[model samples]
Target: MKTFLILSFFALAVSALPLEESERINGENGWYLPQEDGSFEWVDMDVAEKWMEAQEQLESRGLTTVPVKFYLYTSSNPTKGTKITTTTNSIDASNFNAANPTRFVIHGWTQSYTASMNKDICSAWLSRGDYNVIVVDWSRARSVDYATSVMAVGATGKKVAAMINFLQSNYGMSLDNLYVIGHSLGAHVAGYAGKNTNGQVHTIVGLDPALPLFSYNKPNKRLNANDAWYVESIQTNGGSLGFLKPIGKGAFYPNGGQSQPGCGWDLTGSCSHGRSTIYYAEAVSVDNFGSIKCGDYQDAVSKECGSTYSGVRMGADTNAYMVDGDFYVPVNSEAPFGMIN
Candidate 1:
């Protein structure tokens, strides 16, 4: 029965394939479907029902607003978090010192404040230095189909921008000291937040931004280089669940940006997709995985990049933004995966 449901879902999804040229622009080539071995294959579609379904789900509304919550985690209170809202005095009462660097971590679909990605990343930043780490919870908007959640990204991002603006107005937090990181769908949410901000956020790190409905989305609808002063995208499951084409100023294709080293035979593409966050978490505290500049995505996939000499470092290092380039970084199949030399 479970297998039947799964097959039925895919069948429905498959039937909805190949968006119209008038509706979407970037994926004129074709649609890529996930394979059992964590790879993707281009497929053709004859129907527009699924696309219409997505449109109807969003009702053609410009911005699909949804409820959002924020949690503050600081070195003073690592495990326990203080809930923050625009109306409450939480920010002033909590350890939210605007004088310190502030980082906002947003989770992807089906994720909550307790998601491991949030905990791991929040803990990582706290371990590195004294900073205000806030986890954005948009789960109320995510308990739906992927298409609907995709539609809600812009509205959710506006709320995030409002929160940042609130902090700036009340707590005097400068956008210069702010950094936002998000994974998958949340990556796009981070992008939306950056776009809606009063001024550009200092940096934004997108962990394998979702590919499905966003593949052909306009710059404002998805994470792009212009989302922040320094935007970086780490592609782990590219051409599958993650975006294949680089969208940020600095794009890192670790292990060709497809199937990761440790995620063997990832059927759902979750392992490879999730690795972006783990790699980033490790990069924050452990190593600054190094990478060599690539001429293009093809060069990275073919391993044509010579070596890591005079290369750039990947992960939470703010200094990496000094140069803009696409890079190919090798990763180990185990923990401490940052191939830092």
Candidate 2:
């Protein structure tokens, strides 16, 4: 028993997202579904990069064409709270109130609804109080190979944007209160969503935006300052899995954004990458990471960033205008990494 229906009414106006048919691209080397001709093939990282480099017509095939799924939660524990579902082409948010603050938490490659940082972030935000938390699980569009995930990001971003736009226009959702959070590859995904939204998205938080096949690329193709009114980036693993450049107007390079304090010598190169979510979750409890303004990594490493300018806290609660610049935040490397000044 549900009374409301979506996508059915707005079907005609949204031709950009053709929900009728969602066909994933296929190739040879990494990961893919079997084709109609009973052929199975995959593409390696190099081949995947080539596909990403290729010029596509319009990006993400326009909305619902990729079949993105949204899971909504208002409380920290989803088991105790009821869930609201929205399809790739619809905004069937029945119990949700559009006036309140909304946060869209997107997962990275090979991650599912419950697999990664999105859930932690949703819980952290809800633990504070009641808020709309939409966990975007785009598993249908994701594959085992990194390149496929990279190639699929554009289309995925569009659908997320379209869904938000539809909610804003039809349900009276406020765009100014919307915040998009994405980690690793999902970070770039949030950037695209913010970029495509109708009246300008309020904020976008990028936690260690994926570096491979994305960095040193065009601004439109990846996360950047223009994506939202206030774009904050928390970089954890520089030049490896996470990006090295400053994509956010408020960029915080924690401990030089690499070689996190507690990982030890064992390095598959994702420890610091995962730390972004951990630090972000803690920040949600309260942006207590007393980050200081600095000229660059050299100054920060020399303990000079803290002396030049007044320290600013990092997280969702940060005031955009008050803390807009490149910053450096020191961390413990273990749980409860950041300490307040």
Candidate 3:
């Protein structure tokens, strides 16, 4: 009887501990906002701007508008929550409306500061093109040795949930038509956000999602998809920074799981572990690779034993697909006939 009682007590005690205590620590090296004293702040707008500017410069070159919002959070208070600016002139999502305009949510790895800053720049550029953007900042610990082991991916996951709840409860925006983009470790953070939303997100684009530490190796409960139907698509180029394939069940790698030609261990060179938007856009464009066509060739030596090799032959003739006209219009009468890029 005493043994049974002791066992029961032990089990209860184990169960009482927070689930975070049991899971493996993930995203320890992630960024966070530093406090005034250079410790750690929940959200930092100053640092975020740097990341945002880099993204804006890249998007500007292509003349594509990318709406974004930057949210920052402290490491110690992952659930403390942060504010989101909207078109309604209100931080409250309830006041948001369809006519108010659509917004994109961008998150950073571990820390929300960098993500928020990046989103701000992206949003500024996109807003110039008339798209409203918002950043969802939440608290998350800074990347440190001890923090890495004790921190849980769930910490960021919970913050994402809070952001979604705010959107749903306050704004009427449907999860569908919502798009999310994350870079590096931010990719896994975005994945967790998408998973907890229960299929509300229409598309999720992971740019070189962090490997090994925070990947899709775990079971596919709600975080993974088998095809483009559920999660739309997962595009990767020069991934595998630390983890190995298959990152997820349906994770797509156009480069055959190999880093780009010039990528190196230090992440310099061609790979550089940068965004794959250009590569992704290229893969989808039929003009770049020609339409998929199949050609059959039987073994000449052994006609009895037939073998076929499918090939995609180009449509012949270079320069046949060149366009001769400029592709830009003035944003306003003040700037007449302005170039897009």
Candidate 4:
């Protein structure tokens, strides 16, 4: 009778602990926000509430008008970006090449063309190949309140779609060669652009798509597989600043997708969240960001991928054919983050 009572107590204690122990990267803790699909994600309550209020305001007042500007970069002019407009022969006037692969790098809230996301990605693409890198500068929408920036996603996305349409119609740039990459709030902007374009965009890469206001949002509102022909995501700060679950056909969870290595004691998860873009930028230049397919996020968190499952590259050269599951890729704490095969 004593043995039975002790066993029951032990079982209860184990059950009380967090389900996935591997997810607690960087030693961060927070409220567990329940997802629509009955799953729960750890999120900072303050940030979550701000986004929730923003979403509510957005639903009530509709999307706000945002002034979006485009800047083009190429190998010829890597540093100096040529301003491009949707109207009046801007593509023909600028150094826009329709033959090369085109990449649109959209920055997150409080970021502009000068942000590392735009500069580093542009430099990486140029170093890899002669690509057309267009930096979407929507800093005009930024305000003191982060919620106001959330409301501007829709309008900014429409402008991006309009620019895409203008390029396709007038400059003969094929959607097959287009890739839209966005980080944080910009990820949702990419989704909106893809939706506006009727999901005709070739690929959309979401780097740690913001979770605060977007975790419980509908597929049409957030970044999802239906947003593009091939949609993928790299979750660095999942369950906090970033969405916890797989938001795309190909979802990558590096270091459990919660906190990243080298980002020690990240209470707000900004360091880990920024790692998404950093990893992606490096992946664009190097072919070593390898990832193994997993049965689910649980498998990823445990680093015990099924041998039957195949591995795929987690960057610019990701396999479009092998998708539809979670992928786990280990990285170093510092530079040369990709692990050798």
Candidate 5:
């Protein structure tokens, strides 16, 4: 009997070993693959030249172009005992010829795609026409908890501020045109950047800002609109893992904030979590045809409402809300109005 009991215990222990090992591997691997030495080797002068050509094409169409500068940052995976390197790249206004163009920055969430990927995706928009777009690719350690991610965002926020200052002092860009756009965890990063900028930026657009972990109740010391005049817009789709509330100047929802078919709520689809092709096109349309009549651009929300735009939806409980009237301005004056609810 004693021997049988011992054998049973041994069997259970052996069975659990694989589970433990898998967990360890997951921790070591982080949420994504560790950056190999050759990861960024693909980026060089030749690639940059091609990128420049693409920018030129967009400029030919009267679109402003912003040059992209990729910077790498290293962080350790807490779960997996390995070192990972991530790159954060920024797009500058000099690439685009606007006297003093507004700076638009994008941020992503956990397991969010790499900055290079974002650069590739953003290139499409950059080629469309004139606009200064910057992407903040911060070091995102895999599976790093919400708190750790927030810290990373806060640190990057300082870096963004430095970059803005550099652009203003060296490149002669106006700080008033600066804008920040974040998705999921990137939304939290935008919040941090806005807090650090002290209201220098003109607007912030959050796409389905993560809920639960990165929600408004998370006690973020760096979360708040820096200036009363600073406009913030939040659009949530699918069930993001945060405690979302109506805080921005205008919070628009297309399908009542539920995940759409084309927009990948997580990462398992044609489009990642950040910006979907459908959402991108919709955003472009909104930028072009939306209205800005309301005090904080509430009219813009109405413009995007009821359209068959593609993107993830937060859930059934979510509804679009706007805090101010002048959040979004219409690009085309002749476009129809009174559609969005």
Candidate 6:
């Protein structure tokens, strides 16, 4: 009887653990570190080792499990309770409405649930639609190496998939009404989540997915058309921080995909790169940004996307097409970036 009781206790303990043990990277050198000023600094073995030690110390209280948080927001109370919480078991699924669509918003590197584009996304969705918005905040897992975050997000994706499975099993959630929106590195994370799920995520919208070390990577390594039923990639800064190649069913190249207007001749591409999420956020509220189907970027630059001049809407109202293609739109210097004139 004692042995059986111990076994039951062990199982309970295992079930209570967080999603950390699955994040193991094989043959990774772990030498990359992101700078505070949006640059990168290569590290020696000692520095990398110390960084790893510090990260380990932070997560030591939970043994091998790392903390990942999910914040729930709906139209009833759109603007509160965004604090990081690990109490997944206590989630009042009452905050959710199965009749409405659910959107999982994942953020990029060094981003928090309350900060960065996740906040904009959550607010825009709540205001625009009667939807269930889940902001995934993994600020607890800190890694200096960008490669390590990349690898770790792969594991995180599987855990997210498991969460999807749970919702489906318990609350009768529909995969067809589910969508994932991610920016930069979070874009790839969304892909991994869709890949791990039971193959019916409605769509994944990637806002300028990170380009460094991920542009030419394998399909499974980064996000691709196969990640979801429909994938839309909006590239604001191409051939630099954002992916150059069109990696989705509908690839949007605002102002020919690079060097946005009114950036004040910026070379760092920071303003241009960040415009993707801005455009997406705007689209959520208003998807009237006239997007034209283009054969190539040159066609967009020359104001020519085939003989027909009719342009299609690009963001939340885009036509869900299964075929692959490139798209274009004119740009201005400020808010309401996508323009027809």
Best model per TM-score: 1
TM-score of each: 0.85, 0.78, 0.46, 0.81, 0.50, 0.77
RMSD of candidates 1 onward, in order: 5.2, 11.0, 17.2, 11.0, 17.1, 10.8
Candidate 5 least-lDDT 10 residues: 74-83
| Candidate 2: clashing residue pairs, number | 7
Q: Which candidate number maximizes lDDT?
A: 1
Pitting candidate 4 against candidate 6, the one with the higher lDDT is 4
Ranking by lDDT: 1, 4, 2, 6, 5, 3
Global lDDT scores for all candidate models? 0.79, 0.69, 0.36, 0.77, 0.40, 0.68
Q: Candidate 2: where are CA atoms >4 Å away?
A: 1-50, 55-65, 76-93, 140-142, 297-309
Model 6: per-residue lDDT, tens digit, 228-262?
A: 88998888877666776787888888887876888
Candidate 4 per-residue lDDT over residues 1-341, each given as its tens digit: 22443344334434444435555431133344323333445534334444455444644575444788999999888999999998667777788888988999999876788998788889989998788999999974455344456667877888899999888887788898799999998999999999887339989999999875564446776889888888999999877778878888889988878889999987667789899999998988886677878889878877788544355778746566657779998889999998756
Native-vs-model 1 lDDT? 0.79
**How would you encode candidate 3's per-residue C-alpha lDDT over 172-225 as one tens digit per residue?**
656654545555455555566676664566555454554433324343312344
Candidate 3 vs 4: which has more lDDT: 4
Q: Of the candidates numbered 2 and 3, which has the greater TM-score value?
A: 2
Query: Which stretches in model 3 have alpha-carbon errors above 4 Å?
Result: 1-130, 138-141, 145-152, 215-217, 220-223, 226-229, 232-239, 242-250, 261-271, 277-341
Model 4: residues >4 Å from true position, as ranges?
A: 1-63, 306-309, 316-318
lDDT winner between candidates 1 and 3: 1
lDDT of 2 by residue, 1-341 (tens): 00111122123224334222234322212233222233333323344344444424323343223557777777544533334443423345344667668889888866776765776788788888778888888864355445445666877898789878877877788888789999887888898898788988888999988766564446888989889989999988766667666778888877877657787763545678788888999899766787778887556444467543356777847556676777778888677888687
| Candidate 5 residue-wise lDDT, 267-312, digit = tens | 3321323332234334443432232233222333344433342222
